[model samples]
Target: MSGAATSPASAPALVLASTSPRRRELLARIGLVPARLAAPDIDETPLKGERPRDYVARLAEGKARAVSRASDEVVLAGDTTVAAGRRILEKPVDEADLRDMLALLSGRRHRVWSGICVIGRDDRVRVRIVDTIVAFKVLSAEEIDAYVACGEGMGKAGGYAIQGRAETFVRFLSGSHSNVVGLPLFETRALLTSVGVPLG
Candidate 1:
């Protein structure tokens, strides 16, 4: 597509159904300017025995539907989870879990799952799930202590942030780098195009 400006009448209208700064910046990276930003309120509790892929996908769709009350706009929502084997690692709420998470992720491969929901103007919803594999280098006790001391691990999945200090700990990443950062550009851009969103 050309770098031409779409007419306001022809421009795609989307309501981003999330409040994550990382997700917002990612949309800006691909030149999508959402007509609205709606932070959805939904229970994030994982169902008993629910796997990471199913968990993220359900939440993504729920968030989109929960926040899409206003009519005439397309709604987009996403949910991401970090998994170490079958155990899904969520944002740590306590220091003990945080410590365990960091240690377990060290020198091991983990998967990050991101689920995306695109609700079209016609109320037709299309979804996609992206998985990224990452391996963390062996970390020293002192390094983990310093990282946890700074309180940066509190809200991040897998007890680390690839865009921050934890970048040094990543030895290999085998999938969509953007998905691990909270959004998947390739799948996201494709969804937007299907719903008539202009992209360059």
Candidate 2:
């Protein structure tokens, strides 16, 4: 009976520990399909004076572990941080936040950090971090106002979405473009592969 119920050599992996459509889309790009999606509710607040790299890494791991208890299946989780110096920027919840984020990011170089974690069937954990540097072209006051009015930056990390109209602001980029989008596929694929999550 147990043998009849078990799928061998061909079943898709466990679950994506996020509700983000972008993450799902990125996974599909590498042909690593998931059986389910888990939106783990975890405290995203950074500790007192936490560095951007540590913050992202902790968030990803926390999310992965939160979902691990939901099912017997392996879980994949990720987090992204946009930082200028020691300051970590998060998703904007309102217009003011977006405006401030855009102003801070204007005509400057910033670092985007993406942390990925996968909990394997063998109870082992694999993690990876991707860092990308992007420089934005100087933005005019009219352009910034218009962009704020577009309302695209709301709920987006660092108050901007590179895949959207904000791409116009990018004058130079070094490292994985996908990292800025949310997930870095190259690093993600390597992490998944290392954890025995076969990808086509």
Candidate 3:
């Protein structure tokens, strides 16, 4: 269907293949509202020896393809992770895990990587990986304890939320802030537009 013509009335609807409120809110900021929200059911376990970028890319594309899409629908999915060098820090399993993650991140720089995938109406898959480098000030045991007790980082990657109270810990950030939150808007909009998905 190369060079196929399409009409405005037949434009495909965008389907967001995630239920994360942060992602939904981020899309809204770009004036793109998904016609549907699907919670992608996929194993999120990292493959042994998989790099962070590859892991996120695989997960994002997996999610986008897992969702059932109609001929007139385009699916979008994303995966975000916090990486300290080659090590990937996932969501905290418990308070101790959260504390350890915070401690490991204290007074150091880490990278937040997000992989975004789009399954266009043509069934062509497009993926973009965006990374942001962030640095945290040295954290004391008291600060860790207080943050852990507050439970803000419970299910967050790297056991922290840059858009939340954890922002206080950030001494430097060198990339897309929204990527740290969940999705990278600049790349996302680009992917959507490239796929003929209309955006406001």
Candidate 4:
């Protein structure tokens, strides 16, 4: 006889292993509020010569593994990376760094890579990497300086937040918009449903 599908009530509660407000908000949009928030503390330093895609995937899985959870709880984690060619533009440390990142992205096409990891109650791990191509219009020196002065990209990857003021700078974007915001909704829903998380 075939195995029966897992019932929603029988599934474990979801634990989000991230402190990102954007991730939390995105989850709320799908009515999948997490049972608990477990921010994973780990070294996010990229390995020597690690590529952008690998970097994000490793971090997401690492975050999922770092969070403590009960056998009856599923864990979810995600990581986003902005890559200009092979270089990974991480969160800017200061205004100067933000300026530099924006300048590099000016009039250029870059890739936004978001990696999502879901750990089921049975300890099985599922991962998906979503890539979005984004192109920015030619930014003038004045524009970069003004945007940096606003201090919006301080903690955002690639020194910009797509859902904020930076959206005006985008000339073209092709891929999951939610992924650029921090989490990919379609992919996240699929992952959660696979683990028997109630989406409705």
Candidate 5:
């Protein structure tokens, strides 16, 4: 019975440890569909004075380990955040918060940090942090007001979506575009491949 249930060459199932639609879409771009989507329930509160890099890295690994996985399953998790210097700008709590975030980012360079973690079939963990620099053109009061009214930036990190209307505001960008979106495809693909996950 045991012999019939096991195959030597069968690839382990991929489990995505997030429920974000954008993450699902990003994974599909690489032709990999997760066999299961497990949204890990972990406290994401930043430690007092935690830097953006440390904050994302800890969350990614925590999420990956929080999910239950079988021996034949590989878990993948990622966390992304926007930071202005040492300030970590998380999801906007309200319209007022969104407006403030946009105003703060009006005409300066900020960083988007994405931390990716993969736990392989052997339970070996791999993590990588990717950073992207983005600059926004100076936004006028009218522009900020209109953007706030549109409500596109609500609930998004840094109060803006680079793939949406916010793209127009970008004056400069350096590094992985996908990192700013949510996951860094290059780093993610490499980690997945290293952990024996098949990729198209």
Candidate 6:
């Protein structure tokens, strides 16, 4: 007797290798929803004297590689870095750290680097790095304290979230605004599309 016929193969699934809700939100803005969410737990520590751009790129690639999936599936990952000159500002571990980061960014132009990595079904990896220049207004002591008290900077790079109350502090911004919020939608969309991910 002949065996039951198998179903036709389906398109490769799109996996988002991140735990950040902001990224999912950003993807929603472009009407693309990941078929699966795989949060990779790879070492995110910066290498010895790693530049901000390189640091983000490495982490994004690492995250995309860490997720386990079928060969036909696609994985997407991203990393955001806040840089003051050559210094990389990571997420704040405490209120003091948050305050310090705010002070350092006050009335200064800093760089926000976002790296996106997309691994295709054929294991071909594509990366895009986006850099944004953000200028902060001169912040008063009260302003810093108030912002810190809000507790929005706890897990945010550079101890701030531009999409939140921190928007008032930005005097000028030159580049993708979405990058500062954790993902670059335009770059991300282009990367996914290039890798055969369907979008509306």
Candidate lDDT values, in order: 0.88, 0.86, 0.95, 0.94, 0.94, 0.93
**Candidate 2 local lDDT, 69-133, one digit each (tens):** 44346788999989988898888888878888888999999999988988877777788888999
Alpha carbon deviation, residue 188, candidate 3 (Å):
0.1
Candidate 4, residue 59: lDDT: 98
Using lDDT, give the best candidate's number.
Answer: 3
Using all chains and alpha carbons, the TM-scores for the candidates as numbered come to 0.92, 0.91, 0.95, 0.95, 0.95, 0.94
Candidate 6, residues 92-117: lDDT per residue as tens digits? 98999999999999999999999999
Give the alpha carbon lDDT tens digit for every residue of 38-114 in model 5: 99999999999999999999999999999999999999999999999999999999988988999999999999999
**Residue 27, model 4, lDDT:** 95
Q: Worst 10-residue stretch by lDDT in candidate 2?
A: 3-12
Query: For model 5, how many clashes?
Result: 0
Model 4, runs deviating above 4 Å: 1-9
TM-score of 2: 0.91
Error of 1 at 33 (Å): 2.3
Number of backbone collisions per candidate: 0, 0, 0, 0, 0, 0
As for model 5, its CA RMSD to the true structure in angstroms is 3.2
lDDT of 5 at 50: 100
Error of 1 at 4 (Å): 25
Per-residue error for 197 in candidate 2, Å, reads: 1.7
lDDT of 3 by residue, 1-200 (tens): 59967755667899999999999999999998899999999999999999999999999999999999999999999999999998999999999999989999999999999999999988999999999999999999999999999889998999998889999999999999999999999999999988888788
lDDT of 1 by residue, 1-200 (tens): 77987666655578899888899899999998777889898999888999999998999999999984455678889999999887899999887888899999999999999999998877887889999999999989998998899887889887778888888889999989999999999999999888888875
Residue pairs whose backbone atoms clash in candidate 3:
none
